[model samples]
Target: QADVLARATTWRDRLGADTPRVAIATDIEQAATLELLAGVMLAGGSVVAERPAPTTARWQRWAAERVTTVVGDPDVARGAPDAVTVLDLDGSTSPRQV
Candidate 1:
């Protein structure tokens, strides 16, 4: 517990006061997916743990949540507009920018 707290404090200090918002929105909870979400958060961002269904209500909720990035299966954000950024988890070195 002490070590964990120490590391958390160290990271907070390293990231500084103004942590940029990465907004990692995803439904899948695989190791890579979780890693991405955690990475973004640790780097001063957010994680929206939800799946994409392309429904009006879901869209509104996403908008309200200010989700800027979707990371998961391609079908997750299949019909998303070009304005919305999507990252594919296709076993690549990094998230595939789409």
Candidate 2:
């Protein structure tokens, strides 16, 4: 949707100017994921893919990187760094008419 893209652009400007490093966790094919990835790239931040089946060790590794922001399901990010801010994008309804 144009509106969503516009909003994403604004977010990109607000967050991208500094080129902060960001971590993304979601299916790359999903629309929201694509939008977020684009935003992160536009913001000049490195996008690291979070493993769906992340282990404690993996989370620790991510935490060690000091990722300041994360965009993904809150439930999946529970064990990540407490200082990391998470943006949840699970409220969108499915487009399937059925």
User: Evaluated with TM-score, which candidate comes out highest?
Assistant: 2
Q: What is the TM-score of each candidate against the true structure?
A: 0.52, 0.65
lDDT of 1 by residue, 1-98 (tens): 45544544543343334543333444455555545544555667666646556655554667777665565555545445555555554322233334
Judge candidate 1 against the unseen true structure and give its global Cα lDDT, from 0 to 1: 0.50
Location of the lowest summed lDDT over 10 successive residues in candidate 1: 89-98
TM-score of 1: 0.52
Clash count, predicted structure 2: 1
Model 2 worst lDDT run, 10 consecutive residues: 89-98
- lDDT of every predicted structure (CA atoms): 0.50, 0.61
Off by over 4 Å in 1: 1-29, 51-56, 90-98
Candidate 2, residue 60: lDDT: 75
Reference-based lDDT, residue 6, model 1: 51
Q: Candidate 2 — which residues are off by over 4 angstroms?
A: 1-5, 13-16, 52-56, 90-98
